[model samples]
Target: MRSRYTAYVLGLEDYLLQTWHPDFRPVSLDLAENEQIKWLGLRVNQTALTSENTASVDFIARYKIRGKAERMHELSQFELIENHWYYLTGEMK
Candidate 1:
């Protein structure tokens, strides 16, 4: 979860895509268009293993865009496949 946050902070769209599950991965995030967004920080509230290969992370990411502050609170889901973890989906909180 932290790594993914860093990816967004750095505008590493390719890296983000690479870590996302193929079934859930979008074709593009268009991070370049969000250049004006300034990522402030990420706070991981909790994490839980739902199953042997599935887990969820509850986090909040703070940022600013056009001098306006905002935050995203999400319960992110992940799946472990072939010893690697991939982001599956997320639900806004």
Candidate 2:
């Protein structure tokens, strides 16, 4: 989760895509379109292992866009496949 947050902060779209589960990955995030966005920080509220190969992370990310401060709170799900973890999906909170 922290790595993904750093990916967004660095606008590393390719890296983000690589870590996302294919079933839920988008064709493009268009990070360049949001170049004005300034990421403040990330706070991981909690994490839990739902199963042997599945887990969830709840976090809050603070940022600024168009000079307006904002935050995103999400409960992100992940799956372990072939010894690698992939982001599966997330729910806005």
Candidate 3:
């Protein structure tokens, strides 16, 4: 999860897509389109095991765009496949 946040901060779209579950991944993503956004930090609020190979993480991320600060709070779901974690989906708060 933290690595995914770091990928966003660095605008690493390829890494982001690679880590996402194929079923949930979009056909394409362009991080450069949001270049105006300056990521500040990410705070993991909580994590819970939902199933043997599934988990949920609640997090808050801060960013600024044109000097306007904003926060994104989300509950994300992930699945463990072949000893690797893959992002499924997220619900924004």
Candidate 4:
């Protein structure tokens, strides 16, 4: 989750796509187009294993767009495949 946050802050779209589960990966990303977005910080609230190969992370990411502050709270799901963890989906709160 932290790595993914860093990826967003760095505009590392390819790294983000690589970490996402292939089945859930988006066709494309427009990170560079959002030039006004400024990532502030990431706060991980909790993490839990739902099963042997599945887990969830609850986090809050703070940022600013066009000089206006905002935050995103989400519970993200991930699955372990072939000993590697890949992001599956997320639910915004």
> 37-92, model 1: which lDDT tens digit per residue?
99999999999999999999999999999999999999999999999899999999
Better of 1 and 2 by TM-score: 1
Give the lDDT of residue 37 in candidate 1. Answer: 93
- lDDT of all the models against the reference? 0.95, 0.94, 0.95, 0.95
Q: Which residue ranges in model 2 land beyond 4 Å of their true spot?
A: none
Q: Model 1 Cα RMSD, Å?
A: 0.8
lDDT of 2: 0.94
Per-residue alpha-carbon lDDT of candidate 2 for residues 1-93, written as tens digits (9 for 90 to 100): 899899998999999999999999999899987689999999999999999999999999999999899999999999999998899999999
lDDT at 60, model 2 = 95
RMSD of 4: 0.9
Per-residue lDDT of 9 in model 4: 91
lDDT of 4 by residue, 1-93 (tens): 899999999999999999999999998899877578899999999999999999999999999998899999999999999998899999999
Q: TM-score winner between 1 and 3, please give it.
A: 3
Q: Model 3: clashing residue pairs?
A: none
Clashes of each: 0, 0, 0, 0
